[model samples]
Target: MRDIQHIEIPGHTLSVRVDPGPEREGRPALWPSVGEYPIYDPFLYTTMTTDDERNHRFRAALAHLAPDRRILDIGTGQDLLWAREGVQAGARHAVAIEVIEDAFHKAAANLPALESPDRITLLLGESTRLRFAPRADVCVAEIIGSLAGAEGAAAVLADARTRLLEPGGLVIPHRAVTLAAAVRLSDLLPEQPVAFAEAALPYLRSIFGWHGSPFDVRLRVENPPADALLSEGAPIEVLDFNGDLQTQQRTTTHLAITRSGLVDGVLTWLNLWCLPDEEPLDALSMKTNWATIYLPLFDSPVPVETGDVLELTFAAALSDDRVHPDYQLQAVLRTADGQQRRGSLISPHHGGAFRSHSLYRDLFPAG
Candidate 1:
C-alpha cells in the first residue's frame, strides 16, 4: 500500500496516492488525493454521488422499477443502490459501471454483495466506453446539471444509449428544461469598477489578468422554449455532448431593473436531462447540482438604475470533427441604442486527448 498525496491539475483539483520509497517495476506513480469533506468524500461526491439526500430520493424513485428488470446504472457510486433498503424491492439484477478507481475500491467494500457473484456486477471503467453485451431494459443515470451541460450528462447518456442500451430502452426523466434569468449581484466583485477604471491605463503594461471584464450582464428570460434536450438545428435540440453545433443566429434581450445596483456578472441555470419512462431526473426544484457559469461580460462596472434596461446576446455553435469538437461560446452586451459595452467571451478548448494535438486550434476564432 502507498501513502496518499495531493496534486493539482491546471484547471482542476484532484487527489492521488504515491509510493513513499523503493523503485518498483511496472508500477505507475501516484499523486496526492484531492481533499475530503465532512460526511461524504469530495471526489466521490463529484463523480459518484449516492449517499447524499438527493441521491436517496433518486434511489427511491428507481424503486418503482419492476423486479427482474435488467438495468444499467452508469457512473454508479459505490454501488449504493444495491444496499438501499428499497432497491431490492424492485430491481432483481443491477449492473454498475464506474470510472474512478478510488470510488470503485470504496464501493467494493461498501457493496459487499458484489462479491456474491450473483445479483450484481461491478465493472471498473467509464460507462462511455463500456463494452457490455447485455442490453439494458432501462438505463439509469443521474448525470445531469442545472444547465444540462454541467456534468457532461448528454455525452454519457448518448454513449450508453448507443452502446449499452437495448433498442427502445427507457430513459428516466425523459425530459429536461434549462432556464436562464437576468440578475444583479455586484457585491461579489473583488474591487469596485471605478477604482479599476482609473488603474487600467497603467495596468496594461503589467501581466495579463481578468480585470474590467463584465462581471454581470443583466438578462431577461424571454420565452425559453421547451426542449427535451439541447440540440442544434431549426428548433435547437438537446446539446449533443458528442456532436458539434453551429450557431445559426444571434439574438439579444434587454432586462428591466427591479432594483438599482452595479452590474457585475451573468448567471446561467441548467436543468438535468429527464427520461419520462423512468423517474424524473432529480428535479431542479428539488435537489440539484446547480451551478452558475460566470461570464465577466464587462471590463468596467456599469451603474444600473431602477427600470434601467441592459441588453445581452449569446452566440454559440458546436464545432465539427470527432477527432476534435469545439463548443463555441460568444457573448456581447449593448444598450438600447445599439451602443456596445465592454463584454465579450470567446472560449477555448482544454482537456481530453486532443488538448495537446488538435488541428481545431488552427481553425478556431475562424481566422
Candidate 2:
C-alpha cells in the first residue's frame, strides 16, 4: 500500500492510509472520510484507565504470575499497559497483539519505553488468526462488550484456551455473567402511550419492512433514580472463558414488582470475575467504559401493581455476524387477583438474514 494520504473533513484535514485486506472487510470506516486516523478517540482509553477496580484486579492477577512465565495480551491498545504490567510483574515474555495499524504503531512507540522492553514482543495482527511459537502461561484480553459475550469474547477465549495457552493456563477473567432487571423508564415523551407510539411509528414501519429498525439502540443511564428500578436484577447468562462457548443460552428468572409503577423494559449489564474468590466487577454502577444496556419493551410503559409476578424467559444468542447478539424476552405477568398478561419483546433478529436473501438483494446491493 502507498504511504499516508491527506484528506479533508468538515473541520480539519487528516493523514491516513487505507488498509487493503480481508480483515477490513465489512468493518465500518474508522473516520468520517478516507484520509483520517483510525481509532483516534482517546476517551475510551481514558475511561478504562480511570476504572480503578478493573485495573486493580488485573494487576492483582498479574502479581500471581511467577518469573519466566509467558503472557499473551490480546487486543492491546495504544498503551500496551497490560503487557507492560505483566513484564514488570516478573513475566519472562509478553506478547501483545493489536489489529489496528494506527493503534499498533502507538503501542509500538510506547512499548520501547516500558520497564521491561526487551521481554515484550509486539505483533500487529488479529489474535483470532495469529499463532505464536509456544503456548502462553497466562492469556489476557479486554474484548468485553456491553453484554459479557457480545464482543465474541467466549469464542476468542475458547480458541485461545486450546491453541494459544498451555494446559490449565490462566485467563484474566475466568467467569462472566450478563445480568438484567425490569426497570420503569423515565418518560421520554410528554404525553403517554399515544405520543410514544406516534414517535415510534417510523421505527415500527421499518422493523416490519425489508430493512430494519434504525431506532434499535442501547441506552446508557448513569446513576439512575431509585424509583427507576421495578425489580431486582437477575443473571441472564453465565459464561466461562475456560469452558464451552455459549453461543445460545435459554434461562428464566422471576421478577417481583416492588411497587405499583409503569415498567418500560429490562436493563442489563455485565459482571466480570477476574479471580476465583474475588468479587466480580459490576458494569451497572462501576466506573467502567461499559454502560447498562436498556432493552425497551413497548412504545410506552406497561402498568403494573405491587405484588405482581413477572416471569421472564430470555433466549440470547450471538448473531451470525459475530458482533451484536440477539435477545428475545417472553414475559408473563400475573397480578394479585390472578389475572395474567403475556408480552413478548424481541430485538432485531431475522433482519440481517432477510437483507442477505436473494429476494431482498436489491435492498442492500452495495453490501
Candidate 3:
C-alpha cells in the first residue's frame, strides 16, 4: 500500500503518493517515477546548491542583467533558485518553467517566500513547447547535463532564443565547451572488490554460455589520480547558447603524450562560461555538482609511452529525443618510431536507429 500526502503550494495542494518499500538514510524516498524519468533527486539538488563555484558563477551572470528587464527561467527545478536570484538582481518580471510535476510543486511552495512573489509567474510545462511573448530580455536555464548539452539544452535554448527572447537578450552560461583527454583507466577503477557470493554467481552464470551482453557505462569520478593523466584536455566541442545551439558537433585535436602510461579511455568534462569575458566554471578541478566522466575505450588498458602523438576525432549528434546525444571518438596513435594504432569508440552502441523514431520525426521534421 502507498501512503498519500498533500503538499501545499501557492495556488493548490499537491497530492503525492509515497511508496513504502525502501528508505534512504531513515527518510522515506520522496522521488517518484514520472513517465519516462524519475522526479528530480533531492540529493542531487542538494549537491547543486552546495556547489559554491556553480552558484558564484550564476550569481555573477545574473548581476550583469539590465535592471527591470523581463526574465525567463527554464527548468527552474525545485528551489526556483536562479529565478529568485534574478529578481533579487533587479529583473522586473520573471517566468519560471518546470516540466517535472514534483519539482514544479516544490518550486510553487517556495514562490510565496520570494521577496517579490507577485513579480514572478510559475508555469508547469516544457519550455520548448510553450509559447511566450517575445519580450524577455534574458533567458536563464540550468539544464546542463553530464555531457554539457546532453540534456537537450542546445535544442531547448535554440527554441527559446528564437521564439521568446528579444534581440540582444542575454543567456546565462552564455557559452560552454566540452573537453576530453586520454587517461589511465586504473585511475577510475573502484577500490573495493566484489563480494565473494556476487563474484561467484556471475562467473557461474557465464560458464554456461550465458555471458552478459556488453554495454557502455559512463563513470562519474570526483578526482582522478594526477599520475594517470596521459594528455592535456582538448576541446571537442564549443556551444554558444546565445547564438547557435548546434545539434551536431565535430572536432579533431592532436594531443602529445605527457608520460608513458596505460590508456584505458578518455576523461570528459565541461567548462561553462557563465558570462562573456568572465572566468568559466571548470568541472575538472572545481567543487561543482558535475563530476568528470570517464569514457572507456577497451576492456583492458592499452600500453603507451612518452613522445607519442594521439590524434582524436570527437563527434556528437543529438538523438531523435532531442535530449541525449550519441558520441563517437576515433583515435590514431603514432609513436616516435613511426608505428601507428587505430581504434574507435561509440556511446550507446545502438547505431542511428533511435534517430528514426516516429515521435522524434513528427516533432522535428526539419532534421
What are the lDDT figures for the candidates, one per model?
A: 0.41, 0.64, 0.67
List, residue by residue over 276-336, the lDDT tens digit for candidate 2.
7888899776666565666655445678887887888888776665534666878887878
**Worst-scoring 10-residue span by lDDT in model 2:** 28-37
Maximum-lDDT candidate? 3
- lDDT minimum window of 10 residues, candidate 3: 27-36
Between candidates 1 and 2, the TM-score winner: 2
Candidate maximizing TM-score: 3
TM-score on alpha carbons, each prediction: 0.57, 0.74, 0.77
The residue pairs that clash in candidate 2, if any, are none
Clashing pairs in 3: none
Mind giving the per-residue lDDT tens digits that candidate 3 earns over 1-367?
Answer: 3343333334433333333333333221111111112235565678777889899888888988836899999988889988899999998989999988888998999999889999889999999788877469999998786567666678788888888899878888889887888875455432421111111222222211121221222334454554557888888878899776787888889878888877767878889988888888888776676766666554456677887878889888876667556778888888788887776776641223321322222211221
Compared to the true structure, candidate 1 yields what TM-score? 0.57
- Compared with the true structure, the alpha-carbon lDDT of candidate 3 equals 0.67
Task: Give the winner by lDDT: 1 or 2.
Answer: 2
TM-score, prediction 3: 0.77
Residue 336 CA displacement from its true place in model 2, Å: 2.3
Location of the lowest summed lDDT over 10 successive residues in candidate 1: 29-38
The TM-score measured for candidate 2 stands at: 0.74
